[model samples]
Target chain A: MNLNVYLHAFTGVVKREFWRFIQQRSRFLSALVRPLLWLVVFAAGFRAALGVAIIPPYATYITYETYIAPGLCCMILLFNGMQSSLSMVYDREMGSMKVLLMSPVPRSWLLISKLLAIALISLVQVYAFLAIAWLAGVEPPALGLITALPALVLVALLLGSIGLFLSARIRQLENFAGVMNFVIFPMFFLSSALYPLWKMRESSEWLYWICQYNPFTHAVELVRFALYQQLNLQALAITLGTTLVFATLAVISFNPERTVRAAPAKA
Target chain B: MTIALQIDRVSHQYGQRVALDNVSIGLVEGQFNALLGPNGAGKSTLFALLTRLYRVQQGEIRLGDDSINRNPRALLARLGVVFQQSTLDLDLTVMQNLEYHGALHGLSTREIRRRAAEELEWLGLADRTKDKVRSLNGGHRRRVEIARALLHRPDILLLDEASAGLDVASRQAINKAVRQLCQERGLTVLWATHLLEEISLDDPVVILHRGRVLAEGIGRDVCERSDETSLDALFDRLTSAKEAHA
Candidate 1:
């Protein structure tokens, strides 16, 4: 409730996350490598079979790499989101969560600060990936980077909130790595991250409808449109709405009043 | 003298099992009150409620004039804690850990650095500020934790089994330091431990067993009342009755 305290803690939380991100060189490398692999190696193979339509975000046919770039960018956010939650589980196990949990700052503020930190870190990886994509001959509109920053941030918040909600709700949280794999693979493979919904519709109406409904698909579409200097209003509404929903769920689940266990470690 | 902390008939349960059964305690300012109990005597549970990590399901807990459920942030603002578990981020340097904790309490950056340096110097740990917490020994880690606890200038210090895993010398040193803190700072302390050796004969002691308080008085008084010679003997007599009864 204290603004000074809230702002100070917010800065500290973000700095700590940045320190953790930079300190673990391997984690940074892996976050970039996954998206790059899809952009460079996997995109080459899929380029022939997957033909992206001249969708609203696209005025004409685009190369598979160019088309999947936004999706892959969002892929970085998704992985980073899951990674943030995994570290939270690690914090719980290590007892490092005590300082944050016992703080006088409201639990909601603490969580929002953490989510913002995670989102900011995710931006780091997304930009790194975008730079690599540009070097590989997949150039988005130069102004698109500036315009996409806020959209990317919104998507980052959305994904991180989902991750936070999962971190709090999942009971078998010790197996969070397994949980991550299960969630990341399905959410990515099922959504429009890898292929277009229009293309998926040609294969099955059910999958097309599923992709349309997936919040992640909207997140990708938001980034995809923003990268081309276009605003996808439907994507904006879906992403913003989903962000609020998960953020609410995340805060509620992590609320201390709702937690009766002596320590979350035991729970 | 103001009551620094009070638990009014607080009770907690884990499913159908009672964790704390109508436990209560009244502690005045600057008092180093020891919560003496065997394992599973609800020592940790009591600390949880005090720290608001676990909400009070029944009765009320007050810090100064603010009841826990009434204005938790106000109560939390004046509270410091050393949990049974180590809460220091091991990957972070000692100063980083302290600074982060300071920030949590709404300390300005300048204030955080100044107070952190002061507290570390007081704890004799100014030289090791940049060392990663994982690099420090258990005793030094504990010292850093204690220093972090005081960074917020809290009126109450709740150490839940703070000396649980230390060697005898380390335990004695830390215990001595905490005792000194209570005197010098006028900070009320609720020290929870199962170790009878940790409590001085003159210190206020709350002996709890099986989620219930068995004795509530000065250690010497409890020993005298039970016709026991020392705290260790008094503890044995009180807790061993189940074996005799069985």
Candidate 2:
């Protein structure tokens, strides 16, 4: 398709999604509030309870709030991913997804276009949350703000693809809640969102290994490292590779035939 | 006349139950064929398969000599579909909906706007072009959908209960428009409806029951076998017989 065509489709989706969030002001507020609670209330309770450990590239003693900023950022990406997927299910039921699915262009391209749209929006919200965090006095290197953009984009894309992949399988919107509990929670809690890998190792080495291997952990680290203006080759490689894999699987699972069987009304 | 659409022994099933049993039908160029069936009688399934939403398990589908399963994109480009549910974005104006659809088919903005204007005029909806879809009456909304389907000038137009939820006046308007398109533009039309009153006596009607074709022919002739003068009674007999057998 021509660039203008792609731009029209992309802009339509982005505008629709953005307007949806705006219309539901409470949801936008909740998106900001949820992470703020974790940073303020939850982090305050555990700051002194948890011992400080000197890790590589940690220049000085950073408070719990500063340490979990990247994790909270990852949380935003994760939630946005699932939220987009939930909307996909909702649209399918309402027969709106059929409009996108039935377009004459390749289904994969259409799906990717949607993922990119979600990523762009999610990125915007993530930065908004970060700015709010900055106002809350969670200090980061000034240069870190500029460096985290690409890392956030990569994480958002990876998570968005995973959401799209899950969306293709969900028949009803209610089913997404279970995915949130099982996937989103574990991906967040088991990773270095609140604590360090070393801290987890002191408590349980196996848990530390799991955290190290968690793709979300890599996503967080990719941002965490870049926020410090440090190169994180491992994190970047893992995030990029995982993104490709999830994207491929999402496209496969979202095969048009399966989508038809899953929701005949949508097709 | 060249065959504009062809279905060859297509069969589809959902888990344990068959949705469309081995069945086939063809629509020639410039033909308006009515697909008649009761709820759960496989009419929707057939429509889904035709739109490539569901793949055929045992048969092939061809659109103008090209296997739909092989060249879905090319086939889809030449096909227009108005689904049973509302596909129009409620928040978007009618003109905006048409613009997005045209873009998906690779139309430039100027061309899309030009065609959108022409289509609205043709559908007698030029005044409502800028109105949000939710603000329109049911009939006007249906007209917009039909106009959107024609945005790409598809060779074949598929309507899956397009008149559902519309009032009597709107239904008549849609029927008139569809008939006119078939007669004047030579567009192949597959109009799916449960109401037999929607089918014309001279129109080709395919009666589907429980995923199989129960009867196919001129509407009057098919109804005549049961001494039914109208299409409705003919459909009642066909479906009642199947229900009894089941």
Point to the candidate with the largest lDDT: 1
Off by over 4 Å in 1: A255-267, B242-246
> Considering only N, C-alpha and C atoms within 3 Å, which residue pairs clash in candidate 1?
none
For model 1, residues B1-246, the per-residue Cα lDDT tens digits are 456788889888878778788988887678789998887778888887888888889989997679898998889888899988888988889998988898888888789889999999988899999999999989889999999999999989989889989999889999999999988888899899988788999888888887778788878888899898899988888878844763
Proportion of true contacts reproduced by candidate 1: 0.62
Per-residue C-alpha lDDT of model 1 across residues A88-184, encoded as one tens digit per residue: 7777767777788788888888899999999999998899999989999999989999899999999999989988888886544567867667788
Q: What ranges in model 2 sit over 4 Å off?
A: A1-16, A50-54, A257-267, B91-93, B124-132, B135-137, B221-228
Compared with the true structure, what per-residue lDDT tens digits does model 2 show for residues A7-56? 66666566567766666677777778889999989989988987566664
For every model in order, what is the iRMS?
2.9, 3.5
lDDT of 1 at B213: 80
lDDT of 2 by residue, B141-219 (tens): 8889899899899999999898998888889989999989999898999999987778888888898888899988778
- Model 2 iRMS (Å) reads 3.5
Tell me the docking grade of candidate 1: medium
Give candidate 2's whole-model lDDT: 0.83
Best by DockQ: 1
